[model samples]
Target: MAVAAAVIRCRRLNIPRAFVISMMINAIQAAIGRSMDPLLTPPAGNSLHIKASSVDGVQIYTCSGGEWRFLSASASLVDSSNSSIFIGTYAYVYSPKHVSAIGTWSLNNSEGVIAESGHAASEVTGRVIAFRGNKFALPAFLAQASSHLFDGTASLVSYIQQIPSDGGVPPGSSSCRKGSRQVHIPFEADYWFWTQDRQPPSVPSELSAIGLMIEGFFGTGHVKYVFNGTSWQQKNITASMYDVPGGILVGRFFIESHADDAGGSFTWEVFNPNGWTVTAKSASPGVQVDGSSLPWRLFSVTSASFNESFLGPITQVQMISTRGGLPPTPMQAQAVVETWKIMLLQWSFKVCMKISDSECTIT
Candidate 1:
C-alpha cells in the first residue's frame, strides 16, 4: 500500500520513530474521518468559531468549448436583519453600486480607499462548479480574509464557510451554447466566519476553537449555539450519557478517551427519529476540557438524520467546550454524573494548493 511505502521512506530518512508513528496515526484518522463526510472535512487544530452571515447571490456560468462552465459568484453578505453587510465575489470586479464593498473594490478609489489602506477583497474555496443538477452537492468552503472593511466584522476572520443550501445549480447544457455567453443563477447560503481565539459569553473562555458550542447536564439540559445566521440559545433537550463507546447513540458515547494517547471515541445521538450521530475519530492533546483535566476531542459525524438540521448536508464537528464529562479520579466518587458540554459541527475547505495572491481561486 502507499501508506506502507510512505512509512518505509520515513524510516529510511532517519526521521524520529515517535514522529513517524504520530504521522501514521494522523493519516489513519484522516482516512477514517473522510468516511464520515467525504467532501467537507474541517482542518484539525485550534480556531475560534466566530460569526455566520447569510449570503444571497448568483452563480455565474459561461458557455465554453462544448459545455457551460462556471465563471464566478456575486453575492451580498447580510447580517441577522437581512441587510447587506458586505459583497462576496470570486474574482476581482469593481461594483458601481457601493464605494467600500467587501468583495471587489477599486484598487485606487477617489475617496482614498485602497488595498494599501486595508480595503481589500476576499477569496473563496470549496465550490463544486463542474457539476450541474438538482442533486449536485456543493462542498462547504473556507475563505481567507485578504483586505478587510473598516467596520471590523471581516477583519479578524481567518476563514469563511459557505454552508450548503438549495437553488444554486447552473442551467443545463441544453440551454446554453458557445454563443450563449453567460447566465446568472440566483442562490442563497449561510457563510460562517472564524477567528483565532474568541468564544461566546456563555461558553467558557478556556475552551477555544469551537466549531459547535454544546452545553447540557446529563440527560436533561439544554443545547445552545448558532447556525445559518440564526441563534439557538438554551434549547431544551434529553438523552442518555455513557463513559464508553457504542450502543443506541444517545448522549455522549466515548470513542477515544482523552486520557489515552492512542485516543478513543464518543458519539452523540441526541436527536431521535432524525438526528445526527457524531463520533470522535481522534484525540487532540494538551488543552483540557473546561474545568476538567480531560483533553477535549474532535468528532466526525458518522450518521445524520435531523428534521430541522442546522448542519446542512453535514460538514465538520468538534467538542469545543466541555465541563465535567471525564471519569472521576481515584479519590472522587459519585452515584450520579451530570456533565455540561458543547459540540460544534460546521463544514471546512482544504487549503488551496499552489496559490498566489494575484490568483487565489481553488484550482
Candidate 2:
C-alpha cells in the first residue's frame, strides 16, 4: 500500500515512468534475493551470472551447489565511475600484459609504495627473470631508452658492444643481422658487463651510473690463452645467460634465489611469474667473479642454443702446475694474454643493477 501510494504521488508529480519502474524493480529485488530465483545450475566457468539466491532466513549462500553449505561472508556495494560493483576483501596484484619496457608500469595500492617491473632472479641465480612475484619476460630496467648508458658509448665503457634492441647480447652482436635466431624479448637493451660495472674502478664520477654485472660465456670451458689481449680461439666473449623453462619467462621484478650448492662456490636459480609457489630468496647473492681471462665458447640453454660462459678459476690447476713442482719461472710477459683477451670474466655474486636502485627491487 505504501509503495503504491508513493508511485501514485510520483506519477502525479514529474517522475518519469522509466524511473518509477527502475525504483520498483530495485525495491522488489532488495525485498526478495534477486530478480531471478537462484537456479540450481552452476554458472559456466570463467563466466558470470546471478542465479536465485540460497537464502535460509537471513543467511545467504551462493547458487552453486557444492558444499552442503558454503556460508556467505559480508559484502559491501562499491560505487565508482558512475557504476556499482562488489569485490571481496582480499585481492592479489599481477603484472601487466602489454607494458613490456623496463619500468614500474602499475601500482595497485593507492599510496604508491610498491613498484612493479622486470628483474633477474638475482645476479647469482640468473635462472629466470621475475616480476610482481612471478616469472615473466619483463625487461630489466637498464636505463631509459634515451639514457645513452647502454648505447655502446656509456661513460663506463661496457665490455659489451651495443647490440640491436632485438635480444642479441647473448649470442653475438651480429646474430640479429643474420637472423640466426629470433631473440624477441620485452627489453630494448641487450648488453653484458664483464666487470661489475664495466668501467675501470677509477672511471670519472659521471660514469658511476652502474651496470648489470652478469656471467658472460667464453672459450671452450674456461681454459684460454691470450695474446695481445686476444684469446687463443681468436674470440673473447659469447654471451651472458640464465635458464628459462620452455624459453618463456614472465615476471615484473620480484625474484627468487635457487637453493645453495655445496659443490661449488656459486649457485644457479630461477623463478616463474605464473604463480609458482616455490620458496625463494628475494634478493641476488652479493657475489662477483672476474672474467678477464675467460674466452669465447658456444653455450646452450636447451639443445638448439649456443654461446655461453661462466666464472670459475678454469686455469687455476694449470697455474699451479706451471711451476712443474719447482721454483716458478718469471711470469709470462703479461702482454699477449693480458692485453689481447676477448672479454674479462669478473664474477660478482651480488650486484647493484642500477646506480640508484640499491635494494629497490624489494621496495
Candidate 3:
C-alpha cells in the first residue's frame, strides 16, 4: 500500500514524466538504490548507516559516531584493526622473494614487520571500502599479461606479520600481538583509514569522501596503481608508494621494484623511530651497484583475492575513470535520481498495483 502511495507522489503534475531508468535499480533491490536519499541527512547522531547500489555493484558507508568511514582494510588500517575486521579484496601478480637483503638490518621481525614467510609477491587491495558493517566488496583483478621470470628454486610463503613491539596484548606474553593478523601489509603510510568527516553539520556530498585511500606500490612487481581518494594512481615516490618510517613497514617490497639493474641488486632496510628494534636479512646474497630513484625501491609480491561479506558477494565496482565528478553541478546527480523515482512508480504500478494502460491512480 505504501508503494502505491509512493507511485502517486511520483505522478504529481509538478513532477517530471517517467523515463526508462538504468538497470541499477534492479541491482540494488536488497539495499537502497543510489538514486534514493539517505535515511539520515545530518544523521541524528553518529554511526549513521548509508548503503547504495547500482548496476556495477553495491557500496557502503557509515558515520562512526565521530566521523563517516568507508569500511576497508589497508596496509595501515590493518595494523590497529582486529583480525576479524573486513579488509577490502585484493588481486595482483605473484613472485618469490628473489634475494636476501645486502644492507644494514637484522631479522627480529617486531612491530607490524615480523615475517615468517620467505617468498614475496606484488599485491593490490580493494581501493573502495564499501561494505555492510562487517561485510565488504570482493575486489577483483586482471591477471598479469606476463608474470615475472621465476627461477623455480624459490619457495612460496604466506603473509608476514608483526610480533607487537609494545610487549604484546597479554602483556609479557610474547605471542600475543595486539594488531591485525595480516602480514602482507608493510607500513601505515602507504595506506590508512581516512576519517575526514568526524564533526559533521554538513554531510559529505559522496561516499568516497569518507573512506580509505589505501595505498600500494605499482610497476615494481606490485599492483599498477594505488587508490588516492580521487582515483587509482601509479605508484612511485608518492605517499601511496613509500610510507614514512615508524608504521607497519616493509623494506624489500619498496627496494626491489625501484632498483635499476631492475633485477640483480637486492637490499632491505627497516627504520622504526619509536624504539622498535631494526632488523634486516640478506635473503640470498646481494649488494650490486644500484641507482633506484630512492636507494630502496618498494618490493612487493603479487597476489589476488576477493572481498566477501556475510551479506552477499560483490561482483563489480564502478571505477573513477577520469576521476570523480569533480565539479558536481548542483542537482546533476539529483536529476537522474528524480528520473529513477518516476521509473520506480511505473514499475510498482504495473507489477504490484496491477494498474495498466495509462491508469496509474493518484492514490
Candidate 4:
C-alpha cells in the first residue's frame, strides 16, 4: 500500500514511470540483499566471489522400472538484460558402484560468447568449448578448479554454488509408477561462481572517446562521459576496456558544482546486464588526479554480476586512476557541466561450460 501510494505521488510529481520503477526495484533488491541468510556466506579467505546469476530451466527425468530417476537438466543462464549468457546441462551418470552427475555450460552465440555472429559450425567442430562442473545436489554443487575437464574459462573457476531454489521437484511416486516416460520439471535457482584470482583479464582502454564509441558496437562496452563543470575536459582516457561485462561499462555520474559541493556530493549508477543491480559510491574525499588541479573522488562497485563470457563473472571494480570531472570551487566564477576521464580495474572469477562426474558432496 505504501509503495502504491508512493508511486502515485511520484506520478503526480511528474517523475518518469521508468525512473520510478527503477527506484522501486532497487529499493526492493536492497531489502532482499539485507535479508539474505548469513549462514550461506561464500567461503572466506583468498577465495574471491565472482559471478551470481539466476538460473531458469527444467530438470529432466526418466521413469525407469517402477520409479522416476534423474536424467539431465537443460537450462539457460540469463543476465540482467534478459539475455542468455551460458547454456547449461546437468546429466546424471549411472555407475554400478555409485550414481553421480556432471554439469556442463557453453557460451551462447552462433557458436556463442567467444565466437562471431553466424560463424560456421564446421569451422569450430572440435573446437566446441564447454566447462565441466560437479553435481552435489539438485541444481547445486561445488566444482573445484582441479576437477575441470577442458581448459578455458572453467579452468579458472575455483568453485560454484547454487542455493535458494524453487520448484523442479519430481512428481509423486504414483505418477512415476504409471508408465515409463520422460519429464521436464521447471525450476529456478541462484548460482554463484568463485575463483582464486583477484582480478579479471585486462583489455586495452580506448585512447580517444570516439574509439570507445566504436568499440561499444561489438558488445555491451560503452563510454558515458559525465560533466561536472564547464572547464572539465577529457584529455586521454587509458581505461577503455572492451571485454568486461555490461554493468562494469556503465559509468553514470551525477554532479552539481557549487560552494556546497563537498564530500559525498556525487552519485554513480550502474546496471548489470547479468541481472545483478549494483551501484557505485564515493570511496574517499577528493583525491588528486595527475593532470587536474581539482581532486576527483574514487568509487567502488557495491554489487556485481553472474557468469560472463571472456571475463568470467565480475566480482569487483575500482576507479584507480582519474582525471578532471571535479566541481568548481567558490573562488571559481563559472559553474557548469564538465567531462572526466577515468581508468577502471575489474575483478571476476573465470567461468566456463562443461560436465564432469564426481562424488556428490553437499556443502
Give the top-scoring candidate (lDDT): 1
Residue-level lDDT of model 2, residues 196-275, one tens digit each, is 22211221122222222222111111222234432244222111221111112221111123233322212122233212
**Against the correct fold, how does model 3 do in TM-score?**
0.14
Candidate 2: TM-score?
Answer: 0.15
How close is every model to the real structure, measured as TM-score?
A: 0.33, 0.15, 0.14, 0.34
lDDT of 4 by residue, 235-271 (tens): 3222222222211233333332321223332222333
Model 3 lDDT tens row, 1-363: 011122332221111211111133224432533212221111111121211111111122233333333332222122223534322222222223411111111111222322333323222121111111121222221111112112111111011111112110111123224442322222111112111112211111221111211121111122233333333343422111112111132322222444333232222222333111111122222211111111121111121123222212222111110111122123443454443322111000000001111222343
Q: What ranges in model 1 sit over 4 Å off?
A: 1-56, 81-138, 144-151, 198-363
Summarize candidate 1's per-residue lDDT along 1-363 as a digit string, tens digits.
000121211111123644565476467556544222312322232143433344556777778776766666666555534455444333323344532232421111223334344544423222221112242554354333434434223343444445656666776768876579688777776655544332222212232232322222122122333222222232222234421111122343323334232232344554544444544344234355243413443333433345134322332233433322233332432221222233222211111000012211221
Give the C-alpha lDDT of model 4: 0.35
Candidate 1 vs candidate 2, lDDT winner: 1
Each candidate's lDDT (Cα)? 0.36, 0.20, 0.20, 0.35
Candidate 3 wrong stretches, greater than 4 Å:
1-30, 35-237, 240-363
Which is the winner by lDDT between candidate 2 and candidate 4? 4
By TM-score rank, best first, the candidates go 4, 1, 2, 3
